[model samples]
Target chain A: MNTQTIPPLAPDAPVVLEMTNISKSFGAVTALVDVSIRLRQGEVLALVGDNGAGKSTLIKILSGFHQPDTGTIVSQGKEVRFASPRDARAHGIETVYQDLALIGDLSVFHNMFLGREYHKRVLGLNLLDNRKMREQAQLYLDTLGISIPSVNSTVDLLSGGQRQCIAVARSIYSSPKILVLDEPLAALGVRESAHVLGLIQNLRQQRQVSVILIVHNYNQIFEVCDRINFLHSGEIALDASTADTSEEELIRIVKSGLGRKAIDAAAAQVRPGPA
Target chain B: MPPTAIQPTKKNAVGVKVPRTMREQLLILLSRYREASIAVVAIVLVIYFQLGSDGGFLSPSFMSVVLRDTGRLGLIATAEVMLMITGEIDLSLSAIFSIAPYIMALLSVTYGVPLAVGAVIGVLIGILVGAINGIVTVRFKVPSLITTVGTLFFLQGIVVSIYNSQPIVAPVEQPFNAIFGQSLYQPTDALLSWHGVTAFTPFLWALLVVLVLALVLNRTTFGLHTIATGSNIIGAREIGVRTDRMKIYNFMIAGGCAAFAGIINTAQFTSADPQAGSPFLTLQAIAAAVIGGTSLLGGSGTVIGALIGAFVVASLNNGLVMIGAQATVSDIYLGAAIIAAMILSIQVDRLRTRRRV
Candidate 1:
């Protein structure tokens, strides 16, 4: 109920995604209440909240894993209902979960192609076009500035950062209009985190895709995100441009569950930088 | 480091760099195909057994018998490999193998059904039982090992009760028997004297099956998805893979193979024994797959490796018998071989990891 608005960073940019007044419940448990968020074209918007703050519920709705009890989701001005994850994918909304969803036993190209494999018809059988997949996977990686030893290398042998990069690359290769990344840096080390952060930054600079990043680390959010949406107790508490907010202010707002007036009062006292 | 360790890379005519040394090349090959080590072990075993048996192990007639055993066991092992690669196991496959032939024999002899139709029904029953196992495992969330074991006992009980714990002797006519299991070419001194090899139909069928399944596993999207389903079910699902359906399809494939193997056995012997479906047979099939380099943990395996493994197992049994060793001694060797293969596979994995690092 205490949703604070910040001036849009790119006012002229089209809103690629809009979720308004979305509410969801599981049996007796109300997971989300009147949550709404908007993603502008080519903007990286970070959704930051503590545990049990309905960040996952909002994400699940966006990814088509769960349908909202109430509210509408509009993509490019047309309202859409996602009955399943496949439907969401069909609409070009790709989500890379915390696990990265890459099969370890498969080669890089195979993982890149996983469910949506390229196939060539052979004697009425749709056989895998492995050569095409390998070439395309390598080309996609190169275009994304991701460096790996080979597309033929099994994914399990790759480093954590490399695996995350592959998962991101796979989503991007699908040419999703909106990319959702859930805790991509949570399991990675500092150097690996930097690698992923750099990739996100590169994506923002080089691609037309909009990103909704769900992260806990405020420093990472500030480093790569153009805006931040803070969720508190199944509600959006703060919506502000990353340039207009400091990490300390975001932390205070999240820790205190501040009302809109208090958040604005707090925001006025702090400079928008590292503490 | 030794000077030999620092070999220079060579460029082929295509201008691509190639591994400079045989050691490096071998390592590269081994890493790319985990089954290569098992293939080597099988070859070494064949040679060792041939020498130990004074070349009797390699005699055409004895080799035919060994290959026949390989054919039957390889079919089941191939089934296990398919299911295993999808992170499932069908303990009831041997039971399906046992009952399918019985169904065929009963239908053909007692009910006067056509032999070909009976055989098809027998395989269909196997596939049906597999579907049941798959449905129970996926829909009910029962572990496949448990679900299939339940089916195994249930099917075994049905076989016992129906057959009264007796063997049915069904006289299969010519051509049908020949197509299924009878020897295609029996090399004798008078005919094809120079060839010196016997070709059993079952062995040929096994070869064909292995070749086809190998292609399916390596070249098809279904195969890749199966591997992905086994490797990481959660991950596979997240990526829109029908993980449960894949597991079910693999279970069905395992069932079909088991039933086909059983039908082959019936054709070869002209009889179906109710008590033939045993857990020991199931364990042996699993062992063959494991020895052939199929991972018990799943996500990685090859049908060809399993077939070779079947040959290795059959050779051990036949070679031991040829050398006049006790039947129990082959069991001891088999147990040791399984352990050795697992250790070697682990070491090879570690080597790959170390090299990658």
Candidate 2:
């Protein structure tokens, strides 16, 4: 309803990744239609939308869980196709999915280095460098100001906030160019959510890592995000800078996408139309 | 600032510890030493058998026999635990165990191939069968239980039809019998033997395999990926873990272990019984793992636990026979042992989870 005022890209800001004319369909249900979004280096972009607004589908496509029916993805100005999650990761794109980012049964250090374990060569056998991993895990958590009993503690035994912190920390360990997190704060308590929001802000400012975060909370979007992309009915309904938008405006835009049906219902009631 | 940095001095929320109840303390103690609890139960059973049996079950010779059987079963269970933790099951392992030795015997005896080379080829075939099971389950999107069950029957049928329900026998020769199936230190003179003094043949192999696998599971990247993939498949995939490949590799390892077990049995007896290890053997191996504290649901297991569990099963089997129990009764006892182990593990897991909360 309001004019979209996306901030102009800075001259020195390089484009990290661009998904152009992306469209995908699952059977007869069109999930995404001609959606285009670009991430600039060192920017925290927030993707916010109501349920079934194709937010997850877009995230899945970016994370290489699902391929777009029609689209071209350019990473660092080079054309690329991610056939699998490994391919996406190879291009320095890491995604931490919500809820199950870390193995619950594994210790914090083990989860932190799940696929990429540190091993020392001993008698030609690749044995785990557990001491090194444990120390590094402690250092990373300490640097992030996360307090847990120990790195050897299983993640399932940890609080919801601590588990989330470990997941975020693990993603950052890869030094990825673009980190995509799908609903990192969902189901967390208010205080836990605040902690995660702070972690995101710290990541953006200190690490200078580009992020594409999907979240339902508008307050979180406003607090830590630089840019916002709103999806309504399989399309980018609003794309703007956080400085140019407010919570009231976001709610209004979200409501207006379904406003036509509401208006039709109101007219039907006023005119006393037959059921 | 992060929430931790703020350190909100909320009244009554900081470091107020309450004394734990007696039950809580007991649960913590039990869960922390669940393996030790199982080991205690196993030791009691051995003592019970030693007292009841006509022959001294605790005698050095008899104990050695029991350990040798335990070792063979333990090796297979160790392999199964790995697959189970990956959220997959391999029923065809017992089938592979039964048939691989026959293949080795046929190659060595009929084809006049080197015994060692034949054994190696047999084990490789077993690995191939496991790979097929993994590929079908992962690539074709079939449940592993179903895929492995189908493979079990298929392999079993091949072995039965080819061998015509006949046992294949080979001559007991030097080196072949010396390395596997037989005792580690053979007696030169009857008066002063050191067979049990060192280690039994198959048990040594079992111990070696168990130790190596335990290391691989706990101290390697493969182990990390295994736990990750088993714990959360979607989470692992999101982190770029190649879970399908990991499962396939695990299946192959399991198959190879079964083959090794089969070779040990064949070398020990100097015969390859086409129907040696049945579906019952598979059940025994799984029962051993479950008793050892490996979860059926996946993502949590240990080789040490499986090894202990195998000892428990071996004790039950050997004890029953020594106590003059009917052959059918031994099966009943095994079934009961499995149920008991499952109950114990479930309780231990419940306590551990409760402690977390």
Highest-DockQ candidate = 2
lDDT of 2 at A34: 95
- Colliding residue pairs in candidate 1: none
What's the lDDT for all of these models? 0.83, 0.80
DockQ of the candidate models in sequence: 0.39, 0.40
User: What TM-score number comes out for model 1?
Assistant: 0.88
Which tens-of-lDDT digit does each residue in A1-275 have in candidate 1?
22223333455788889999999999998888899898888888999888888888898899887899999999988999998788899999999987778999999999999878899998998899999999999888887767666788788877777788888888877878898999988777676677777777666666767889999888888777888887777887777878877777788777765655665566556443221
Cα lDDT tens digits, model 2, A1-275, are 33333334354788888999899999999998999998888888989878898988998888788999999999999999989887888898888877557888789998888777788998999888999999999898888776676688678777666787788888878888898988888767776676777777666666777899998777777777778887777887667777766777666666666643543343233322111
Model 2 residue B117 distance off true place after TM-score fit, in angstroms: 0.7
Given candidate 1, what's the lDDT at residue B340?
A: 84
